[model samples]
Target: MSKPTALIKFKAKLSRPATPKGAAWTFLVLPAVASAKLPTRSMVTVEGSFAGQPFQATLEPDGQGSHWLKIDNVLREAAGVAAGDSVALEIAPVEKEPEPKVPADLRKALASNADAKATWADITPVARRDWIHWITSGKKAETRGKRIAAACDKLACGKRNACCFDRSGMYSKGSMGAPEAAE
Candidate 1:
């Protein structure tokens, strides 16, 4: 029997910028900036079949284009090649768009947080989940907040993920079982 080695590159896309449902058509035509240097990375769309399952690993450039993409968790899991299996790779560059920026106010609060850990304990489970999703999305903790002041402000202002969250110390959906929900 011959040992298998070398997965293949499949469908690859330089993750286009995040777009609202309405602006999608316009975004399709945005010009690409050559300096993004998307080609220098060694891994593009790694095409191959893994564990009888066909899959493609994608290389998405981080927002700050100073290096290769963040960890390609999809490929790592797709291709069972691990431990001693030697592997080969191929790569290419495409004009990719940056993901749309999250709303400034929500981004600011999430970015400027300072009480993440302790804040969760006091909030409801739903609120806790919101905080978790907000914090975990980032790749680095240094880029996260340690306090909830910023989140609280957004909540006070009724922002969503990219907007302000409604605070009032009351769950807007009445999930917290406030007087409003009982009536």
Candidate 2:
């Protein structure tokens, strides 16, 4: 005997009691369980039918080990099932997965710089990435060396907020001076 494959699509409704009249259910339900094998990343369309009118929905990975079913259209139209109504979610496979969050070090590198005012203002964090890319993207030592001193100097001041580890890192305002000698 071989494993069976699905031919006809089916609707799987949640086993929840319907919402009371004129009430709002504000919550998110994740990764609906079904008999069909839902591939991790696949393009899928889910349809909702109410009062003989139908609305189509899109389902994608919610990035927390579950799928995000978009109910934008269905929610707007008058339907038999309320928000908490035991709605059925039908699915198909999709092609792409959600993008991952940036690592802490990368975020620190992007957000902190010693020249807290100027360099930070010049570019958005995404743009900072380009600068980071240009500086670190280089394969040659001299090219990287050229930016070393000024970049470090700017960061050392602890004033810049956009490209260093600490966005609030600030240099003390104390003065560095010696008594003047009079002739």
Candidate 3:
């Protein structure tokens, strides 16, 4: 894919806990800016800079026909930004999708099950990422193992992706358990 010559730039206020039902996180991106890129997928990986600090993130649609780039704590600190602060952003589309790393145990499990492996290959990249995220996001080793086992079983049964996962980050409480304390 050819890269757009003009970098899309915008000034947006950093917002936290984007919505009451969404994940307790901060982000910086406007719908208009995102729309100009004409993303093919709801979630698109973007390479960009915020306050001059280079970063890469996936822009997720905001249900309201707009997209937002999640700003993690690390990026916030690096950029010296806070919620409600106006920040300048320069972004461009990433031509290639970065593959999420599959945990060793999960890899082993998939390798042993040919049917599951075949099914996994048939799923979309986004679906595969959700499964990987579900497995890796586990707070505990047991939780991760359970997720892995469940994924293998589901894949073997021809399931495309994990259900109940808030891939869009909306409706997700922090760490998939507790809600963020309202400010």
Candidate 4:
């Protein structure tokens, strides 16, 4: 679908993640009301402006039913924004979903299984993204490995989606959301 003619606009202060202790990510949590206007609670791509600097990004769920926008170094520098600075944003969902890059491990697994690889190729980009997200969302190495194995098994069985996977992070007690503000 075409992006709405009018973009959804809001203002928020930048913040950092609480874990990792010294993470450099800068992100903003969208107001729940604004987030409700999006197509889905799961990850969604949008073209927008950050502090008036144009950008495009895939927004991630905040685990509390909202969304967070991450500002990469390039966008951060271009927007001239820093943590604690309130910035204006205007975004609209993109018409087409972008393909997610497959992780190396998942790539290797898919390569080894022809049936899984065929199903992976047959699925939609959004479905593939969901599979990738479900696999990568695992915080522990063992968890990720299990997810890759499960994904391959499901794909080999001709599963088109990550069944029962909670892409929004709302139903799952997982790491999702903007990083806590650093003191």
Worst lDDT run of 10 residues, candidate 4, spans 174-183
- Candidate 2 regions with alpha-carbon error over 4 angstroms: 1-31, 46-53, 73-76, 91-183
Alpha carbon lDDT of each predicted model: 0.34, 0.38, 0.74, 0.88
Model 1 residue 21 distance off true place after TM-score fit, in angstroms: 40
Task: Kindly list the per-residue Cα lDDT of model 2 for residues 41-82, writing each as its tens digit.
Answer: 222334434223465544433333334443443453454553
Return the number of clashes found in candidate 2. Answer: 17
Superposition error at 117 for model 2 (Å): 35
Which number leads on TM-score?
4
Which residue pairs come into collision in candidate 4?
17-179
- For candidate 3, what's the RMSD? 5.7
Q: Estimate TM-scores for all models.
A: 0.24, 0.30, 0.62, 0.93
Candidate 3 TM-score versus the reference: 0.62
- Per-candidate RMSD vs. true structure? 19.1, 20.5, 5.7, 1.6
Residues 1-183 of candidate 3 have per-residue lDDT tens digits of: 575645778788787762566554676556565556655435667788988899988776554445667778888889888887999888877767777667789889999999899999898777887898788878899998899999999999999989888764546654432122235
Model 1, residue 83: C-alpha shift (Å): 4.2
Full ranking by TM-score: 4, 3, 2, 1
Greater lDDT among 1 and 2 belongs to 2
Candidate with top lDDT is: 4
